[model samples]
Target chain A: MPADVTALELAGLRKSYGGQAAVREVDLRLPRGALLTLLGPSGCGKSTLLRMIAGFVEPSGGDIRINGRSVLALRPERRPTAMVFQSYALFPHMTVFDNVAFGLRLRATPRVEIADKVRRALALVRMDAFEARFPSELSGGQQQRVALARCLVVEPEILLLDEPFGALDRHLREEMQVEMRKLQRQLGVTMVVVTHDQEEALVLSDYIAVMRAGAIEQFAEPIELFDRPTNRFVASFMGVSNLVDGIVERDGEVSFRFPGGARLPVVSDLPAGPATLALRPEAVRLCAPDDAACRLTGTVAFTSLVGSRMSCEIKVGETVVTALVPRHGSGPAIGERVGMALAAEQLQLFAR
Target chain B: MRGGAMPLLMLPMAVLMALFFGAFAVFGFVSFLQPASGMPGYQGPLGLSNYLRFLTDPAALAILGETIVFAIVVTLASILLGYPLAYIMARSPYRVVRSLLLGALVLTFLSGSINRAYGWLILLGRRGVVNDALLALGLVDRPVALVYNWTGVFIALLHFTLPYFALTVFGSIRSVPVQVEEAARDLGAGPLSTFFRITVPITVPAIISGAALVFSLAISAFAFPLLLGGGRVRLISNYIYDQLFVAFNLPFAAASSTIFLVVAIATLCAFFWLEGAVTRRRAAKRGAA
Candidate 1:
């Protein structure tokens, strides 16, 4: 319970099925009252890692410590952790009130205290009015709220959620993501969420661990992970559409040499060698062909409207670059020559 | 084409049902006639004398009451013995364990009923393996009366009905999502608590349905009691068989068959009603909460 001690820690945690490893040597230290998201694609071992922390799935190696004490030997029911499953596994035979009070009843809490705590937990999720309803009677979002209340009522030391909004529609999923973040801040409870959605992680997490295969690819804050991804995989996963393979040349000044003898000024600390430049579509501005700020010249091959932005695919010496510009006028026509001005600060360079 | 072909496809089943019900109707009509000492063994002048005789005969009424009580006991015993087996078969993590249990149950189902009855008699006879083991172990001073009475008949009947009960409940238990039980454990309930509170309650309807099936199967039992009862454990089916074959009184047999049919139908109706109430009360209990 000390402030300096981490709320949850995993040291060299691993899981393997037969010869194939599902999670390999994961180490994390989450401070108290902070939310961390394990973001990854399907089958990336995020769910398995979360299950290890919840004491549902036994780790193949290493230890999981909660409150600076090892909980590896404890059973799931004995551990001080609760999880909200993706399917919202609520007891169909029990009312919402009883579902929330189940853990308290197991602990032999007083009847009056159980009722009081269940009521407050339901209120926390804005589901106090549905105490008398069964889980089958509620909508998906409402059942999700009850599922959250059922876990929160137990006052676990660490809360875990496994793709909690995977069943909801888009608009509702976004709303619950924001609401979950707000509730976590208000309660100041340490939490871990597993999700395959990058946007959901960005909206809900204090720190995001983008995972690939069975390891953490990059772990950082939202802005840092999006703007300064450490590798090509992280860059692509963060929606960087343009990855131009080039070489860094330090002749006179730092410059990136493209494959077809085109050079563009860049700022990097890497020595002159092979590298890849990660450019976001929205970071490129379409301008007049003779503009002084133009960094590349190409002919537009295709144009399409994306909401309020126009996406243009420009062919630059056998390499196609996509630029997203505001849809004010008719935008660029196909086969029209144009200049692309890349934002210098937003450009990311990665060693190949 | 979809709707038109359905009825034509059902025509054979309709004819089969008509023949079955037609035979039952003839038997029911015979219950109202008077028995005569001749071929066909029936006369005109319809009356309820056969029914009145059965309603008044204390010995016959006693047999009916005893049969009902025995059926109830066997049904309750099957539930107790079969539920755990069904649970293991449905939820055991090991495929070998589940397959072994299911294979044994299915093997019992596939075997001939008379063959199984004779097998039980050989195993449970006075000088049979079970009694010999008990005597050799010095657990009993004498061989227990396991056959030729109520005990032998009860054991055989339970064995016969267990597969019906267990298989009926197995599919239901499998349908209860594994995550529901895990959610209970994640919420601080132990394994046993999760089973009783979450898994069992959710499968109540199936349990009742299985119990109903076993009850009806046990109540109308004719072969086990005939083979193992040693003329002592005569159930309703045995009584009807005696009246028809031994006594050659077709009208009386028809009357008793009608009564048995009515009782069986009533019991099945009650079970169905209880199943509905269990499901409805789950949703209705919300108001009280």
Candidate 2:
């Protein structure tokens, strides 16, 4: 394969069941040795798209090319892609070694070479010592590791996983997410992971494709997606809690006019009338009501502890904007009047 | 609720067990006695003469051997035909197909054995529907004898046993997750390979159980042999019936029944043992690999 050829390319990929679309016009191109994540909520078609790539699902209209060659006509057994199911569908009768060796045995690899490859694969997942145990005897996380080894041992052109850590507890899920990222980098295998957890996607993916309603909402790096989401849905999905609907009037200098007669200067090329401003919770700061830089004034309506920070919901007229501030000495009391400061560069404006 | 009521709850089961075993015990005791001449019951003198006659008589031993061999063949044939029926019943995507297969099996099960045997007679007789078709098609110059022989008995016994085997394995096949089989395919195993290596091995316990049930049913059959055998395909059950009714030899019949019971129990035990060994060997095979 040429160096310029992409590892996986999907163009206009779509699937519909009974005339109802499950996946619609999906297009993506992933270079070799990169990890991409399809991040979305349940029923958002992320898993459906991954299954299409692995040849388990047939596309109603689209092209799926592995290494720049169309693989639409191949069967699942003939495809070069492997999938780790959400349920970690390991054969319960087979031991870990045999489970990982299943693909090699099917390919008619020599006995000695199969043993070597299986051992190496097990060692990669840190499960070499438990190779002789059945899947029923292993814990959830251990079975997940074995599932990964089973896919990796075959050296698939692209590895796909559907909600791989959905079964693990919170603590173990985080640990495995980081470990999976490390292993992916170590092997430098092109991989696509589907997850509903944004944090897991951020921790593992080199590029994230945020999806909603069977369409890609945004595709960018984690920092880029978090810092600058293009739409309100993407903003909300990326954990931006404060969205203020207002009007923009460009009188010599552009400024956003709030509902309660509050005005704040903003930088935007959008010739706007009605618009929405997405502000990160951490970007809003609380200060004395009479502070010189105070752009919006409100009374503290609610306060709650969030780890090392205090989250306050400030009521400005009928709209409530949340601000996350460092917890210092119980923070601001409820009913206290406060002024909210907004960061200029952090403001993302979207035409409503 | 406590220990006080436990024995009372068990009293009905105890009574049932006593009645069942009490009859067998009486038969066993009678097997050791002497048959009274010109009577229907046994006499007082105790001896092993009945067992010795059954063990040493070549003609009687041949019937026993033939019955055992026939049962084994019927059981194997049932599994070969029934597993595919079960797989289709559990896995067909069409609701109408699954329902039709289940309905057919249940209908076969609900019908009386003698009814099914007579139905087979009408289908497989010399001038029956099958032979008529063959003659009309010019495949056979004359009507072929398909009844009143071993073939008739075999066909009737298979019809009687197929439902038991298929229904027994149907639930087990359904319980094997579809994703597990898909995983095998995703790992490069073709559909047939996946079925044989994954689906079949996973359902081995159910297959063994189904085979055991039909094996017992086939070995102890009486009605089909009597109705279809026409006195030529006499099995052990018919032979024992003749010994008791025709010859009025109660002691010898009791002895034969005792021997049959022991053999059937041993065969079932061996089937269960094979199932256990298969599962255990699967686990132990990991070390060697």
Candidate 3:
């Protein structure tokens, strides 16, 4: 294998079950040491795509190459890939040391080398002291750590994770995510994570492949995915709620006009036609109804303090415009009148 | 569903236990009594005469040894025949195959044991179906001696217990999630290694229980031995039957029955002890983790 070759590649990956395609035409190239997340809602073929890469699910039409070598014909264990199952399928009968040493023993590795590798892998995941413990004795998060050590001990070419932290609580999940990110960086292992949580995807991935209906919607950096979604599905799926449907026009400067006399000038090169204006909730600054910078005015229908920001749902005529403002500075009380000013730099337009 | 009904249900269970326990107490008392004198009005003073007779007699010792051997052999043979079937029932991909195999097994179990033994007798006897086929195919010069012997008794007992062993093992195997096995494979274990290293140890408790059940059943078996043994291979149960009914030696029968009860309880207790050890280890493992 060439040094510069991609660590894992899926070319024209297609899978169908009983005449219905589960994943279709998904092509990906993951560089060594880069964490890529396949982000999608459940049943969107994201898990299927990850399983295909792991060689657990055989593709109906595709080639999965690891480090420039095709592994399509290889079994899951034979592939240079390991997966941390979502259920953290740790063996209940074996201690953590034996579980981590299982792969090495399968290859008939020397007994001393197996013990050393198992210990190093456990220490990498900070599970060194828990080696004698069985999985049944561990918490969900500790079980996941052992699972990671079990996979990492093999020193696989790539590690596939299927919602690895989905079982933990909010605080523990965040803690584990940071721990896993640090471990991944320290070891420099290419990782492909499958998750439905966009927040998790953003926090952990270098790039995200947003999938919908067995196809990739957008494959880009996390910031690019959040800030510049390519289509209406991507816009709504990314949790950007201000997707105002309207038509684009060239009146000296291109502007969009919606029903109820609402209009906004869109700085875009889109041809004059119907389009959707997407704005992030945080991109809208709140103002008084009489403020000149305010483009829309309405009474605040709902308000909640989220972290350091106040999330307000302002009823701008028929539309509910969500605006996040700092909680310290006059957070909108329920039923209070407020206005929204859109940030032009953060605005995105897509064809309806 | 009322809790009150629980105590009511126990009433009948208590009565049944009292009835059997009282009879067993009478048997115990009888075992300590002398053998019947010329008169049944009163035997000699209470003594361990029948117990001494049983311990010192070579014929009784042979019957006891044969029972243990029969139990061990049949238990092992049943496990060897059952574990694969159990694994297939638990892990087979096709629903029809698993259901059909289980259906046949359950159906065989539902059929009376004596009927099944007779069914086998018709198949394995000198002029039975198996001999007929072998002779028709010219595979044997003469009909093999399969029935009216220890082989017949062993085969019949295995047939009676195999479904039992397989069912228990199947439940144990099913209790284990498929992902655990897949995890073993994902961690680089091949199919054989996964089964031996992962599957077998996890299901050991079930295997032990199945072995205990088969052993106890085979040791105390009467119907299969009576019909199949054909007076040639008498087990402890068959000998006890003769001691009580044919020889009219009630004290000796009572003495041997008490020993039989002790042996059965001991074997089952050993299995339960093993099961508890496995469970405790699992609990300790979980607590440590």
Candidate 4:
């Protein structure tokens, strides 16, 4: 209950559907006013976790504490939380004002107070002008904003959104993501968002909980997750990354030896054995061949022009290593031999 | 899309009006004819004697009152039983249960209403299964009079009306997005309050349409009411029948049928208009609120 404590905490949170676990040992401590993104692919238990927090899905085992108090026994409405559903869930019969005022009305708030709160919440989401319009009349972005207003009007301790902007177009999605992030900061309300888009997660969340196979793979700041992913799944799942199979040789110098005999010296305490060495596309520097601790010479097999970067796939013996270089820079053409330098700091060693 | 076909489309409309409503139009015209009492057809020098007799006859008036009361009560009773059953069928979590309920409904529908009414007659008759069970259970000392009265007719009619009520209510409730109701609960509405605030308000159109259907069917019901009501309970349709075949007065029967048709049409129109107006008013109120 302390002011510095987390707004929400899950201790050994688990959910099973007929003996198969949907969420496994989900332990999280979401700080007050912090926006945490439950980042994962579909069926990775992010939505299930969010629903458990919302009390829509009861945990098979564990404690869900909101504001440092256990709320597993409370119904969704009794909990100090509100959710912005993936479908927006706006009542078809109600106007924008009524939809936004839905939560307040349930609380038996006075007419004048409800009106004021609804207006303020709508204005917070920049949807004040659309009060008289029905949800069917609004665009996707407008409806999402109204959904947010509906949650905000309730003044819940935390706000949960499941793929909050999944229904919007690419342009509108990006715009709403930024706008919602700003609103979260402005309101200083704790939020837990579920999304599979890593870039959106990075841009919107203060911390990202990368989930896979019904368990949290890593829960850390977005920058840390991008740079120092705890496992190969996180490293490869985040974006384009080269996971070359190799064995660590820790004699005299720690170096990775691929099955094809290509060597890249790595710094790791992992015992000498087979491993998957992770290197980001951005971290693989293209350089002239020379005697270096972490360098490999390979021929570029393909080059894909992606935004302002040319992502080239290089073949080093039987392994294809992907690397990103700026588009404007001089780089190896397809079938050209090139020397690739791997940064040791960026090398993620995952033991088999 | 085909602006030029507007007049051509009226061809079907004209044909339908001529084939169907044309009979009623003829009846309306005949209702104004003066006829000798108890005559099979009018010996006319056009007058309003038939219509006036229909309006002033005591037996006809009683039958009219009986028909209206029967229809209203049947509509309400059907709704009370139907809404909950429909709600269950619509929201049943198990697909098997939903399918079974729907299958039973369709099977019942495939069987003619008259056959079903007769089935109900067998079940509710004094010497039938229901009364026998009641007697065996010591719930009744002797067989009670269920048939040959309004109660028998009502029960028989309800058996047919329930299916309409269920199907319409089920469709209307099913059309409401499940997420909307979940959203209501998430917003702190209890189950009952959520039903009143979200489910019921949204399904009003279906309720009104279903009620109108049941009401119209009940009022014009002929065979079931005649079979069950026997000689005690006479409805407008029975009276119309008596005037036609029993008394052999075609002009008076035609006049009475015309009045019944007009009233049924008027009731349907008023209900629909009321539904539309209420929807608009709700929209306006919510917008202003």
Q: What is the interface RMSD of each candidate, in Å?
A: 0.8, 1.2, 3.0, 1.6
> By DockQ, highest first, what's the ranking?
1, 2, 4, 3
Candidate 1: Cα lDDT at B157 = 91
lDDT of each: 0.92, 0.92, 0.87, 0.88
Looking at model 3, the pairs that clash are A137-B286
DockQ class, candidate 4 = medium
Residue-pair clashes per candidate: 0, 0, 1, 0
What candidate 4 gets wrong by more than 4 Å, as runs, is: A1-3, A291-294, A327-330, B1-17, B36-39
lDDT of 1 by residue, A1-352 (tens): 2346699998999999997999999988988888999999998999999998888889999999998999999999999999999999999889999999999999999999999999999999999999999888999999999999999999999999999999999999999999999999999899999998888988998889998888999989888998899889889988899999999999889999888877889999989999998999999998887999888888999999999999999988768889888986888889999988887888889999
Instruction: Write down the C-alpha DockQ for each prediction.
Output: 0.79, 0.71, 0.50, 0.63
Write model 1 residue lDDT over B11-76, tens digit each, in one string. Answer: 999999999999999999999998888554988789999999999999888989999999999999
Instruction: Compose the digit string of candidate 3's lDDT tens values, residues A231-289.
Output: 98888888998888878988898887765556777789898998888888889888777
Q: Record all residue pairs in model 2 with backbone atoms less than 3 Å apart, i.e. clashing.
A: none
Most TM-score-accurate candidate: 2
- When 1 and 2 are scored with DockQ, the better candidate is 1
Of the true interface contacts, what fraction does each candidate have?
Answer: 0.88, 0.65, 0.67, 0.60
lDDT per residue as tens, model 2, A104-173: 9999999999999999999999999998999999999999999999999999999999899999999999
Q: What is the lDDT of residue A322 in candidate 4?
A: 89
Predicted structure with the largest DockQ when compared to the true one:
1
lDDT of 3 by residue, B169-201 (tens): 999999998888888877787789889999999
